[model samples]
Target: MRTLRDDNILKLPDGRQLGYGEYGDPNGKPFILFHGNPNSRLLWGVIPGSPFLPGTRLIAPDRPGFGLTDFKEGVTTLENWHNDVIALADSLGIKKFAVFGPSGGGPFALACAWKIPERLTSVGVFASVGPFLPETVVNASPTVRTLWKYAPRLPGLFRVQMRFFAWLARYFPNLYVRMILTEFSETDRKDYARLKVADFLRPDRSEGFRQRGICTWYDAMIPATWPIPLKEIKIKVFLWQGKEDISVPFAMGRYIAEQIPDFEATFINGFGHFWIFEHKHMGEMLEVLVPPSSSPRSK
Candidate 1:
């Protein structure tokens, strides 16, 4: 995928430098995109002509330990994650904005909603991870279930595993890409084939691991303690789920929808975990989260 322009750096109060890339309109309504695990800000480049481009300033930040962002000490919990986001927004002079979280990014988006609902216009989660309870795990894909069950307890093992994958992604790019494509459902496979998505994914996958393989592994291994105060979120909340998603499981979305009051949940049949970035699905989500408005466009 082609790299986007306006890759900027923000120096936080603690002197940590945060790296981010700007997509779409620079002066448009701020819309933050939280990338999935093992991804960086560059992941946004994969979405072709994103609908948010019309009137939204899509901000993709390289989360701690990813891309050019430096990792901070004692910044592991969800609260710390949200605070980092808030700090970034403050540095950018943004008071309010919408947030979109896909896959592993889901929990971080929810953290923003939970911690700073007063500063948000809306929250959107697509193919997200819900409360990681026993019931959710029982119904999840074998790979997902096993990771959630054992990763935390075996962090060293998980790190070693990620390092191996990173080595494969760096050296045997084509084979590594094929290994990932093989995990998608039939519907996802069809979409991916038609879209030629692998080209866009290659850079992010390779660079993301190269920069923060250990940190990503550590973050993924941490267990999620549920009952996240979803009921307290005052901003508009939208949930998009793929009924056929094996990575997160449909049950996770259902559970989250039940917890959030007045939340809009859309379940797409035959879609998989990657549906959020698929052309049709992504268009639908952008329409709901960033409808074309007559309001003056950002400068």
Candidate 2:
């Protein structure tokens, strides 16, 4: 199938390479996008006419282990993820650009802010993460217990474990939804068909994702805590979230805004994890986060 948008390959400064797409003028102001895990270059493809597109040049790269990029079979960590992205920007001859990280793509953008704060116009997150997944859902939910029901080729013993949990959750459907809703509080409650399946998935879907042109994104499930060194970041910061989301919780968006000093800026409400389109105050959002073309620094 011909892609709905133009795509290209980017060779980084260090000899490593990756696939990417540049929307709008290549010479225009750079606005690089970072996609979440278990997805290819598709996540960044969603926003074409977003309020930010008219004036900003958009660049999105496939992460090392995700999209078409590769590294043997070693574990993929957030730090490695960050370096690979920086390499992508460097490859493009982009000294600095406004950075956008959505969902699992958050850490990479933050890492750039930390490592090269000067090369940033701003750092933004939409339905991104910072804290560990909650434990109550882990210890109590039957939905996660039966997380393997959709796995067909698993060994016999694993099937038993899955079936047992399925029996518990399936028979008591309420408990399953409750557990999953609690567990996925950041994304479970949002509108669909907007962000596409790229924003949400079941565990078994991991294998299917590879078939659709993405490596497994299970690495995101590994828990960790991190701070983005906000005090050192001099660029403007923006955050937005969808209230009904159940995957990364709107609270994190607020947390990010408040934690970062320098006039924490605006946090728009009612936009779900997938709701980056048609924002009522888009021009204002852009004015603040996208940097002013007339701003002295931009000059």
Candidate 3:
């Protein structure tokens, strides 16, 4: 429940500030948490309570302009975000830590691998977007347009396509939430609704960025276009994908897992997009990020 709002402002070289939250032991090694598109870090408590709280130090930050973070006037590219993450960790005096990227948080986590693998002990990616081909977008559901607004620059009629998506978010907010909610499994839906979904599930919660629909549109271009490719990364990776994932098709997850240089990929049949949040094995997941402390000998 503690947040960066109470902590000192973490300023990046470019002068942007990151909104972050810390849970569990402050002295413990850090594990920064990242959430997905249209979401703030509020998605973590969906597990009823974070498994990270007992011993692990979990730092959850809202993307600039998303949650409690100030959306400053600057380009919110992968590099900038990554640097901000680094700056945040530096501000906290953490030299090494693991990263947990879930859904939208996946891209930022991968960026951490790309930029600061030397400082990482482990990295876990959950159903994140990979290098998607533009052809996929051309053939994607109409929802793809909503995801295209944030790309570097879209010549020709791309802006017009973005207009349509903005229209949907503005006029059909309820329907948009339902469309997104449909991707979550039944239990995750209940868990999310009851837990931490409110800050991220509505336009009002993301009011500053609501009209700046470019972030979603920009997220679309990422799978098709990565400024820095994952193939160039040097980190060993672990991932969880659900075969039935609809939001981010499990097929995409499988594709990335196979292609990443050193990866351990796992797929759970019948599991869907939100399965990472729906997991009964999160304790194991946390163990990967924060290993248990050694115990004393018993009598």
* Cα lDDT tens digits for candidate 2, 1-299: 11324457766555555777666545566777776644456554444334453555667676665545554334345545666666767766777677777666765676676676677767776666554434312321233323322222344444354344344443554554444454443433343334343233333123224333223223333223344554565555666666655455555555556655652434445545556544433334445656646422211
What is candidate 2's local distance difference test score? 0.52
| Model 3: worst 10 consecutive residues (lDDT sum) | 136-145
How would you order the candidates by lDDT, starting with the best?
Answer: 1, 3, 2
lDDT of 1 at 44: 84
Selected candidate, larger lDDT, 1 vs 3: 1
TM-score (C-alpha, index-matched) for candidate 2: 0.65
Better of 1 and 2 by TM-score: 1
Better of 2 and 3 by TM-score: 3
Question: Candidate 3, which segments miss by more than 4 Å at Cα?
Answer: 1-8, 45-47, 70-74, 134-142, 145-173, 181-214, 293-299
Ranking by TM-score: 1, 3, 2
Best by lDDT: 1
**Candidate number achieving the greatest TM-score relative to the actual structure:** 1
Off by over 4 Å in 2: 1-5, 12-15, 48-52, 71-76, 133-190, 193-208, 211-219, 225-235, 263-265, 278-287, 295-299
Of models 1 and 3, which has the larger TM-score? 1
